[model samples]
Target: MNRISIIIPMLNEADHIDNLLTHLLENSSKENIADIIIVDGGSTDGSLDIVSKYKSISFFSSPKGRAKQMNLGAKYATGNILYFLHADSFPPKNFDTLIITEVKKGHEAGCFIMKFNSNHWWLKLAGQLTRLSWQACRGGDQSQFITTSLFNNIGRFNEDFTIYEDNDLIARLYDRKQFVVIQKWLTTSARCYYTNGVWKLQYYYWRIHLKKWMGADAKELNRYYKKYVC
Candidate 1:
């Protein structure tokens, strides 16, 4: 049987972790989910305690970057597939079945179409764009699923990226024509938009994309994120 290990790389997500876990446990079957691994990046909040309450979950800690945390989780996974999810993102019902069906149909890796949990017109427009297979629309919040074999073959996410890591992976996959965009919708938090202001956030995002296109290195991207994002 093809089994999936869901890896969620988290940091100070105590408020969202429990609800996400409950939803996953309720919607996914034991036969499909081989393991649920929560990789924490040393959250100072009560996130660790909340994760510990879920006896079925496996937990691990990493230094601080999301790429590092997810890589650590992947190292411990025993499933045939790895589903990298965000704590504030909710995949549609039967998501595991959807992914397995796609993989069985020969897709090496893919991500769900996604919407921001906001009613802003701009955000809605951005969400609609994700339904397209355009590489520019990809983001970490959409959640990624890859066969373990393909993941190993392609080499995992680039740990050097402190930001724009998802785009980097998607870019590589696009180059090899190994990426797909599932039609299912994933609802992801708009907390960043809300915190940073929608228009301003969108502008910075475009700037980052432009910078990457202009050959900005990972360190430069990280500096931009530290200065403007968080």
Candidate 2:
């Protein structure tokens, strides 16, 4: 039987963690889930206290990086499939069954098409673009699901990247032609766009993607991110 282990890497997400946990359990069948692992990257906002209240979830502390945190959680996961989610993203109803259905259909890996929880015109346009098969439209907020064996075979999420780790993994999956886009909507928080202004944040993201394509290393990418996004 294929069971999915949901892995979430978060830092200082105290505002959303509890609600996200509740939403996840309510949307999917517990029988289809092997475990829900939450890996924290040194949170100081009492996120740990909030997470500990959920007995079904397995929580651990790790060095402050999403890639590293995800890898650690994955190492302890016993499920045949792994679902990597963002703390502020919510998948569609019966999301586990949706993923398992795709897997059973011979699709090795995929993510739900995503929308931002906002009404901004630009963001709406961005969400619409995600429906395309082009990899340029992809981002981490889509919530990736992959078979554990295939995940390991791809060398897992690249720990060397402080950013663009998701893109890196997705790019590799695209290279192998092992990727798909489920025709469902996942809603992700647009808090970053709100905090940084929509246009500014979007521009920064585009620049980062361009830099990565132009042969920038992880350290260089980190520098650009720290300079602008952070």
lDDT of 1 at 179: 88
Residue 95: error of model 1 in Å? Answer: 0.6
Query: What lDDT score is found at residue 31 in candidate 1?
Result: 96
User: Tell me, what's the RMSD of every candidate?
Assistant: 0.7, 0.7
Model 2 C-alpha lDDT per residue in residues 72-133, reported as the tens digit of each score: 99999999999999999999999999999999999989999999999999999999999999
TM-score for every candidate vs. truth?
0.98, 0.99
Candidate 2 segments whose C-alpha is farther than 4 A from its true place:
none
Instruction: Please give the clash total of every predicted structure, in order.
Output: 0, 0
lDDT of 1 by residue, 58-147 (tens): 999899888889889999999999999999999998899898888888997999999988899999999999988888889999999988
Off by over 4 Å in 1: none
lDDT of 1 at 197: 93
Clashes of 2: 0
